[model samples]
Target: MSRIGKKPVPLPAGVTATISGQSIEVKGPKGTLSFKATDDVTLTQEEGAVAVQPRGTSKRARQQWGMSRSMVENLVTGVTQGFKKELDITGVGYRATMQGNVLKLALGYSHDVNYEPPAGVKITTPSARNDVIVVEGIDPQQVGQVAAEIREWRGPEPYKGKGIRYRGEFIFRKEGKKK
Candidate 1:
């Protein structure tokens, strides 16, 4: 049996969940989010909680059971608290600034990189720190994807560690060649 699937997702106050067929929709103060489960799993709404169970004893069904449960949980959390990701720029001339909804980045490139966030996501460069970038959205996947895309533009190098990276990420240092 799947331990995570067995536990029902509790609905917090001011949050409501509706399950129809194989899909579940959750609405909260922040926003509304929906998730569709595979046919191998069954979704149900109980008293102040949601539950997931496999349709059969097959391995795929069991896997879907746990996955569906987690998806439902994420939906609840997304609508209630939303998600956020922070990136740090490291270099002598690297910096980030927000112009309206667009993000302007200077990573020692010949031209500034202009990034426009998608409809549901928001990108900002805090005035206190121009080297820090903040990504926020109701969907955890979108927030993480945007942060990853920003990091991909200038990944940290092993020698100088100059690039964009997650705020708490660690970069392994490498020694320089002998003179």
Candidate 2:
């Protein structure tokens, strides 16, 4: 038996959840999210809570049951409170600014990089901090995907660390050779 899989996920008020065959959809106060259930897993809802169960007591079923339940849980939370990812610019001259829906990145390059924020994702630069970027959205995967794409524009360099990186992320520096 999977402990996490057996645990019930509480549904909040004004949230609607539906299970049809191998698909589960959760509509919450923030938004709606859906995911496909695993082959060896089944989901049951009762008393405003959802639980996952495996079809058999096999190793694979047990493992997949927990994973499926976690995915469902993430969907619920994503539609409710939503998700956000923060990135920081590390170089001295590197800075980010928003021109309408496009993000202009000046990363010491000859030409500036422009990234258009996708629909449903919000990018905010609250403070004057040169390195701060906040991205928020109801879909966890979309938020993360956009953040990753933005970071890829100028990934942190191992030498001068002149690039975009997630907030609080540690960068490992290599020591120079002895003379």
Candidate 3:
């Protein structure tokens, strides 16, 4: 049996969940989200909770059942409380600003980089140096993807440890050679 799949997902207040066909949809105060169920997994939305069942005893089916259930649970929680990703900018002259849902970043490069926040994703700056960028959304997948894309704009350098980085992330600094 799959431990994760065996657990029932609790529905938060003000959130509604529905299972239709092969997809599950969740609507909450934040927004609406949906996920497709795998072939080997079955979803049943009961009274105030969601349950997952594996179709067969096969290894793959059992594995997918747990994953699908966890995914569904995440969707429900995301729509209710939302998710966030924080990144810090390092290096002189590196900064970020929000202009009408667009994030413009200066990363000590020749040109400036701009990122347009997707629907339901909010970006905010808490400091003048643009060292802090907070990305918020109801969908964890989307929020994480956006943060990753932004980080890719200017990855951290091993020599100087400069660039955009996630909060609590540790970057191993490489030492310079002495000739």
Candidate 4:
């Protein structure tokens, strides 16, 4: 039995969910999101919560049951509180700024790097620190993807500990060469 799959996703106040075939749609103040579960699981709404159950006692069915439940839970949370990721830029002259819908970055490169966020996601640089970037969206995956893509441009290096990293991320420092 799947422990997580057994727990129903409680429908919080101001949040609504609908089930159509294998698809579940959740709407809340933040936004509306939908998820389509595999055929091995069944989806339903009871009282003020969403539930997922497997069709049979097979391995795949059990797997889908847990996964489907998690997806539904994520949808609920996403539509309610949304998702956000913060990145900090380190190193001399490393900064990030928003121009319209694009992000302009200066990571010590000869030329500036420009990035355009995909639909439904917003990127911003707070007033206090241009090097601190915040990515917000209703979808957690998209927010994380955007943050990762930005970090890929200038990953933190152990030697100088300079580059883009998560706000609270800790970079391991290695001993430098001592002649």
Candidate 5:
């Protein structure tokens, strides 16, 4: 038995969930999101919570059971509180700025890197700190993907540890060659 799958996802106040056939739609103050589950798992709503159950005793059904439950929980959290990711620029001249939904990054490159966030995601560089970039969106996956794509442009190096990285991330330092 899956411990996580056994627990029902509770709906917070002002949030409503509707299960129709193999699709589930959740609406809240932030926005509306829908997910289609596979036939291996069944979705149901009871009282103020949503539940997921496996259709059969097959291994595939068991796998989908827990995954479906987590997906449903993420939907609730996404609509209610949303998701956010923070990126920190570290270097002598590394910086980030936002202009009309476009993120301009300077990572010691010859040309500035212009990144345009997708429709639902917003990227912002706080005025107080140009080195910090904030990614916010109702979808957690999109927020994380945008942050990762930005970091991929200039990942932190082992020697200097200078580049774009997630906040609170640790970069292992390497010693320089002997003269």
Candidate 6:
């Protein structure tokens, strides 16, 4: 039995879900989201909760069962509370700023880097120094992907720990070379 699949996904107040064939749609205050599950899994709603079960005992079916349930749960949470990711910029000349929809970044390079987030995702610099950035979206995956893309511009190096990194991320320091 799949433990994650067995747990029912409870619908919070003001959230609604609908099942059509293999696809499920969730609507809440934030927005509406939908997911299509594989044929190996069965999705059903009962008593204001959603449930997923394997159509057969095969390994593929069991795998889809848990995955489907998680997708549904993520939709519910997304429409209700949404998701967010934070990034921290570190270095002597590293900085970030937002001009309209464009994100301007300076990371010790000869030229500044400008980034535009995809649809449905919002990026903002909350501090005047433009060192901290916040990415917000209804989909957790999109929010995380955007944050990763921004961090990729200047990954943290062990020496001096200069670069862009996710909040709370740790960079191991290295010793300086002997003179």
Q: What is the C-alpha lDDT of each candidate?
A: 0.92, 0.87, 0.90, 0.95, 0.93, 0.94
Worst 10 residues of 6 by lDDT: 85-94
Can you write out model 2's per-residue Cα lDDT over 32-133, one digit (the tens) per residue? Answer: 889998789988888998888899988999998999889888988987899999998888888888888888889888999998988889998775965788
Tell me the lDDT of candidate 5. 0.93
Q: Which prediction has more favorable lDDT, 3 or 4?
A: 4
Query: In model 6, where do residues sit more than 4 Å from their true spots?
Result: none
lDDT of 5 by residue, 1-179 (tens): 88999999999999999999999999998998889999999999999999999999999999999999999999999999999999999999899998887899998989999999999898888857699999998898899999999999999999989999899999999999999
Write down the RMSD of all candidates, one decimal each: 0.9, 1.5, 1.1, 1.1, 0.9, 1.0
Per-residue accuracy of model 4 over 32-144 as CA lDDT, tens digit each: 99999999999999999999999999999999999999999999999999999999999988999999999999999999999999999999999566889999999989999
After aligning candidate 2 to the native by TM-score, how far in Å is the CA of 133 from where it should be?
A: 1.0
lDDT of 6 by residue, 1-179 (tens): 98999999999999999999999999999999999999998889999999898998999999998889999999999999999999999988799999999999999989999999999999999998889999999999899999999999999999889999899998899999999
Query: For candidate 2, which ten residues in a row score worst on lDDT?
Result: 124-133
What value does the lDDT take at residue 80 in candidate 1?
84
Q: Give the range where candidate 5 is weakest over 10 consecutive residues by summed lDDT.
A: 120-129
TM-score, structure 3 vs. true: 0.95
TM-score of each: 0.97, 0.93, 0.95, 0.96, 0.97, 0.96
The residue pairs in collision within model 3 are none
Better of 1 and 2 by lDDT: 1
Q: Which lDDT value does model 5 have at 175?
A: 100
> How do these models rank on TM-score, best leading?
5, 1, 6, 4, 3, 2
lDDT of 1 by residue, 1-179 (tens): 99999999999999999888999999999899999999999998889999898999999999999999998998888888889998999999899999898899999989999998998898988757699999998899989999999998999999999999898899999999999
Candidate 1 stretches with Cα past 4 Å from truth are none
Clashing pairs in 2: none
Best by lDDT: 4
| Candidate 1, pairs of clashing residues | none
